[model samples]
Target: MTAPGLFVSFEGIDGSGKSTQARLLAETLRARDRDVVLTREPGGSPGAEEIRALVLQGDPDRWSAQTELLLFTAARRDHLERTIRPALAAGRIVICDRFADSTRMYQGLSRGDLRPAVDQLHDLMIGTEPDLTFLIDMDPGQGLARAKSRATAEERFEDFGLDLQTRMRAGFLALAREFPDRIRVIDGNRAKAAVAADVLAVLEAELS
Candidate 1:
């Protein structure tokens, strides 16, 4: 029988460099002859990609928090069914840019106190969690500045401004505390190479 696959996710506030790290890790693993699938939340599958455009490119207030939660859950369901599950079943490491933890922060805590609802919907529609998660921690001000510099259309969340970023940083930290065993916090204020090295070391330890 094939060994079970590993599910890994990288999460952080906008512009925290989690996306870059995810890509770098995927490249490194592939170089080592490991089968890896690099994917992202809200756009991992065809159906999820459609939902991503609807939720990410609009005005900050285009959808209410409750509405956004439902949309995200739907997207996650499709992503799991079409991308994540299949890869894991095939014994390939799945490295995702974001996962349910993002919904817990963005739709659950950022907009309002709808965490219970997010949890309920998550339990009902999507029930998978990453085996390991890297929470790249950085100052909200710097992170927001970096995010805006990119000027991507997915700036809807970044458009919320520094205050929201601050809150999100705190929320993600608290979440790390909540899931200390599975979530590893990394300081993202350093150079890209430094952060990437640290992440790789931690991941290698886990793999061993």
Candidate 2:
């Protein structure tokens, strides 16, 4: 009988190494002869990718926090229908670079006032959450520096500055408290290999 699919998500402040860790985990799982799908939001699917450009590009103020939340929710819905759900049904281990938690932190703390709305929208639309979430915890200063080191057009969220990133880190931590059973906080300030190993250990415990 085919085993049930496992859904894992990597989340943290921008530049917290979640992306790298997500990729590394996927590689490790595949090396173990597991059928794995490494995907990311808000561009996991074709329709979501189209929305990704709109939300990640242009001026930082291109959309209000509420509007941005809606866009993300729309992209997430599409990603689920077209990419995530299908892969999970096929019994593939789905590793997502950033899932709904990102929206909660980015929009929730960035605007403070919009957090309730973000939660409401999420509950109403994108209800599926990852089975395991790795919150790559790190200092906002270091994280922002790392994020800025990368030259990418998707600077809309990265452009929020250090102050916001600081709050985002705190927000993510608080969020971790809310989902202790599913969200594991990993120290991301360590070397890449070290963080990857820690992530792998967590996966080994949960997935094995």
Identify the leading candidate in terms of TM-score: 1
lDDT of 1 by residue, 24-53 (tens): 999999999999999998889999999999
- Pairs in steric clash, model 2: none
**Count of clashing residue pairs in every prediction:** 0, 0
- Model 2: runs farther than 4 Å from truth? 1-3
Tell me how far the alpha carbon of residue 64 in candidate 2 is from the true structure, in angstroms, after superposition: 0.5
Quality of model 2 by C-alpha lDDT: 0.89
Clashing pairs in 1: none
- Reference-based TM-score of each model: 0.98, 0.96
lDDT: worst 10-residue window of model 2: 1-10
**Model 2 Cα shift for residue 9 (angstroms):** 0.3
